[model samples]
Target chain A: MLRLHGIVGDRRDHALHHRLHHLEHHDAIEFLFVPEADLGRRRLRALTDRGTECAVSLDRDDALYDGAVLFIDDDRAVVVRAGAPRELRLRPQGTEGALKLGFLAGHLHWRVRFEGTDLCVVLDGAAADYTARIAPLLDDGIVTVVGNAN
Target chain B: MNAPALSPATPAKTAPAARVGIGGPVGSGKTALVERLIAAFAARKVDLAVITNDLVTHEDAERVRRSGLIDPARVSAVEAGACPHTVIREDPTLNIEAADDLERRFPGVELILIESGGDNLASTFSRDLTDFWIFVIDVAGGDDIPRKRGPGVLKCDLLVINKADLAPHVGVDLDGMIAEARRVRAGRPVIVTNCRRSEGIDAVADHLEREVLFRT
Candidate 1:
């Protein structure tokens, strides 16, 4: 990712940076989901607006937090949403279940938090559909709805 | 090739000072190591300067400056602005600028040591910013640290297990810890040190002279 390189300074990269800067003010808003672990990492992203795609370079030593505005101007701003781009919630049976769920969440690069005995996971939407196959690996933890996130 | 008339008369850029990064978790003896290095390098007469990064304060820089080991003027402080690792790895522009400034102020400085703000094992220095880096961890932090095999432990140019004299007091198996570190690094250099007693420091200096400074 270009942003992972630190700063976008070359003329070509500068032009794209300015273009994205302009898009930040337009009515068409795009969502960039930032995982908790990636909050402090440097990276580049590509965004599309009405079939036109452009690169957005985040080149500063900046930390991305949930609800932090990624881009802003007088008219509108693009904000960050916390959690995985997709997610799943599971109700674990006990301590072993919690450990299994935690291990799976880490292995899958899913951000997870516990609500009492319930495991709330933020991960890929596709993985949520595999609830039938995943439950057996989690020490009999039951799968819940896939889309719910905070 | 035809060039502008002014280009031919322009002075060529000088070589920048070699930069070394010191990074480790909080309370891991990074500052202590820096203090020792200051004295060691000074005795060798290596023209050097230092840069210290702190989260919100210049405490580490102040400490080094007040230690009287090196000139206070040679030490610079950088505030990491809450993202400690980001300043060193993700975007090292600020540190680069500081190192450049040091080179400017103390012309002919051969080396610059950049001390990162105390952070977790995930922290590392950007190669673009540092020519070489040393990761310092202590025996008191527990032997499991090597088993964890964080990127810092595996990737640092040199790994320093500091506070070795405390191994007996802390119930750490010194040889076992060093053995695991060697295993994880696959024979990369790992140095055991007791900064408090100034033990095993010459080896570090020798490694830097050969590896970083190419001094033989």
Candidate 2:
């Protein structure tokens, strides 16, 4: 299990904007003092060893986690796992690919709700008809509990 | 305190230009209520856009788009995927993105009314998502509704008592319902409307002017 604690008190929150603007400046990168941000080094190492460029989340809201499939290193835009993250790993059919998915699935605070055709979506909180939809996603590994911070 | 240094320097995101949310139980005239607000706001030259969520399809959004009240492009539909409250309240990132996209496409838009997929008496909007939100419940829904004190009834900025025209037919007392709603809300604001005939829309718009646009 990846233990990423100390995020609640970290000042990295202030630098997200600066990094978002700078080419060399990366938001959530070198900005995270939170120990809970890292997925276990073993999994990330195995994937990188197989040439899969992996990114761990530095904050919860860079995107809502309800239906998150994977994070990309290039732009960090979350995608529905359209086999895109698999392609990032030069070896598509290796343990590295499966391990990445494992790390994502194991995370409880990742905040995603799985839907039709296995579409993992960033959960919507404002909708009135939202409860009925999230009920089942909670049962599927697709939905996870996340975002305890203010 | 270092207020400026604590928050991002970027311009704070303002509330969407035009957002009017119609929330009520299934068939309390949420869609019909939206149609009337569209026509009323339009009559005043308020540029507008709309969003609707349904159980499984574009049923609500498509209905409005076909009404010819507004351009089809101005109307967008979001599938609730089951949870209606979540899309409008807790984490409204998707709705925010949709409203932002609408504002980008139609810079002239003065309002974007978000109609919640019909929900129960307990539903309400989060301030983070909307500058102003209106809750629609009908006299026919029962005068006891206001007395029950659901969050949607009490918390909305404006509590709209719709379907007033049908009150007598359904044995509802419009006057008493309005009085009770006012009492429960601690006299914030309430409007009665017969959306089917466009009655009482002016009061609703007037409330918007005073409360949302600060026209007063």
Best prediction by lDDT: 1
Q: Candidate 2 chain B: minimum summed lDDT over ten consecutive residues — where?
A: B1-10
Residue-by-residue lDDT tens digits, candidate 1, A1-150: 111212223212455446545653343333456556445433324332212222232323344555544443343334455555554667665566657666665554444556666666544346635464466754343334433643
Which pairs of residues collide in candidate 1?
Answer: none
Where does model 2 sit among the CAPRI classes?
Answer: incorrect
TM-score value, chain A, candidate 2: 0.19
What lDDT tens digits, residue by residue, belong to model 1 across residues B122-209? 8888866776789999999998888899999998879999999999999999999999999999998999999998887888888876
Model 1 CAPRI rating: incorrect
* lDDT (Cα, tens digit) per residue for candidate 2, span B81-107: 877888888777777778778989998
Q: Give the per-residue lDDT digits (tens) of candidate 2, residues A77-144.
A: 22211111210111112444334433443342223333322323222233223323444444443433
Which ten-residue region of model 1 chain A has the weakest summed lDDT?
Answer: A1-10
